[model samples]
Target: MPSAPPPVPPPQPISDLPHLTRSPPLPDFFLAALSLFVFLSSSSSRSFKLPLLCIQSNPRRFLKTPSMSFSHPNSGRTPHDAHRLHPFASPQSLSDWLKPRLPSDSFASWGVKPGTKNVHNLWLELSEGETSLADSTPPIRTVQVLSLRIIDNHRRILLESHQQLSDGTLRNRNRPLSEKMKPNETPESAVYRAVKEELGSILGDSDCSEIVKIVPDSYKMKIEERNSASYPGLPACYVLHSMDVLVEGLPKEDFCTVEEEEYANSEESSIADEAVSVKKHFWKWVSLDSLDF
Candidate 1:
C-alpha cells in the first residue's frame, strides 16, 4: 500500500527567516555627549523650522502635498489615549475580528473616506518580535524610537543632538535621552534605561533623593523615508514616541556641555563609527521657557 505523502509542514512566518538590516552604531559616550551639546545650542540659539518633504513612493503617481500635524481636533483624543481605546489595539483584536470576515471586506478594500486620510498615521509599525501578515520588501523596516523631554527639578529641559547639522540648517535635535525600546520593554522602563545609559550613576546612589516623574500622556509621530533623506532604503518608517519626564536631584556638577569634534581617529573609535557620517553628539539643559514648540 502506498503511504500517504509526507505531511506538509506549516509555513513559517517571514520573521523566522534570516534577514539583513543595518542601523547606525551608538557613538562613544564622549562623542555622544558632545553631539548633544551642539544640537541644543544650535537649536535654542537659532530660529528655523525643519522642512517637510513629500515622497513619491510610487513612480506612477504624483506626490500629494504634505500636511503637518496629525491633530484630530474633532476626536479630541491624543494618539496615545486613543490607542488604548481602539478596538484593534492588538493582533488578537484584529485576528478575532478578521477571522470570520471576507477578504474583500478588509479595511484597505474600503476606499479612504474623506477627512480620514490621517487615519493611516495611527497604525504603528511592527515592533520587535511582533509579526505581520503583510509582505515586506527586503531592507525596508519599521523601528520604534523614543524621545524624551527631560525636566529636572530646576525646571530646565535637557536637549541633545545626535545628527550633524550644516552651518545654517535647523538642528536635528532630540532630548538628552532617547533610544529604541528593547524587546518586552515598556515605555516607562525604556525611559529609565535611557537615563541610566546616558546620565551614568548620578541617580543611583542609595542616599540619592532624586525623583523621576513620567507624564502619563505621550505623543507619537510616523516619519516616512520619503520625508527624510537621511534614512535611505531600509528602516523606511520611523515611529517616534515622545514623552515628557521629570527627574529631581540632578546635581549642578553633572551638568555640562560637550564640545563638537570635527574629526575622529577611526582606529580607536567603536564599531558604530563605521555606520555614521557624523561622529559627534552633544547635550545641554535649557530653561522650560526656552522651549518654543
Candidate 2:
C-alpha cells in the first residue's frame, strides 16, 4: 500500500511542526526595542496615569520644606516670633506639644488641682484630643488668674502657704491668695469665690459679706508672664489680674489653716467620695515689706 504512504506519518504533532520549532534567540537590543514599542502602544490606549519618576541628584533639595510659622486669630505674633516661640506660638501647637507631657487624667496626680474651670484643665482636655475648645474665645494657652492682695490695718499681707506631701515628704512654698478665673467668670466674682473657698472655714458667710471689702480701683494691674513654676516646661502665659482686698476679721498675727484634700483610692476611681487620704494646706499673714512684691 505504497508502504502505507510511509504510514501516512501520523499527522505531525502541531507543536512539532517546522514553523512552530524554536527559532534563533533574538538580540538583546532588538528584544528591548520590541518591549518598549509594546509598552508605548499599551500606554497610549490606556486611560490610567503612570507615576512620573523624577531622577534628582539631591533628593532632599527637591523635597518640600516644612513651614516654620503659625497663625492665631487673637495672637499678633510675627512669623519670626512664632518660629522662636515654636509650640507655644499657637493654641494648637501648644496642645500638640503638651499632650505627650501631661497626664491623661486630672491634675490631682500632679499634687494640685487646677480646678474644673482652670485653663490648665482646658489644655489638659485639649491634649486629650478633644476639639471642644478649638474655637472658644481668649485662646487655650492664655491663663487668666486673680491674685488677691488682702491687707490689714497693720499693712500685713495675707499670703497662703502651700505644703504638699509627696512620697511622705512635705514641700513648702508661699504665695499670694490666687485662683484661676473660671469660664465666663468676672474678675469680681473670681475674687469672691477665691475668698470663700480659702477663708470660708475662718470667716462666716455673713462676716465674709459684711466685713470683706474690695478696694475700689485699688491698684488693679494686668500683667503677662511665663509660667515655669506651676507645670514645669509648660509654655503658658499667665495673665495676672491683681487687686487689693481688705478683710476685717482675720488674725493680725500669722495663723495656720489646713485644707483637707480627699483623693480617690485609685487613679481610675470614679466615685467622688471614695477618698483614700487627706492632705493639709497651711496659710499665714506676712508683712508686705517682707515680700519682693
Q: Poorest 10 consecutive residues of model 2 by lDDT?
A: 61-70
Quantify how close model 2 is to the true structure by its C-alpha RMSD in Å. 18.8
Clashes of each: 10, 0
Model 1: residue 263 alpha-carbon error in angstroms? 23
As a whole number from 0 to 100, the lDDT of residue 79 in candidate 2 is 28
Q: Pick the candidate with the highest lDDT.
A: 2
lDDT of 2 by residue, 235-276 (tens): 455667788889877766666554433222222233223222
Provide the RMSD of all predictions against the true structure, rounded to 1 decimal: 31.9, 18.8
Q: Candidate 1, after superposition: displacement of residue 259 in Å? A: 16
Q: lDDT score, residue 76, model 2? A: 44
Candidate 1, residue 114: how far the Cα is off, in Å:
43
Candidate 1 residue lDDT tens string, 1-293? 99899989998776576673455677799798898778878766676566999998754321111111233323342334423433454444543543343233333322132211111222232212211222222223344566778776677877774443322133355555666554344566667666655554455542212466786765455554432233222233555667888766565532432223212322223321322232233566778887774
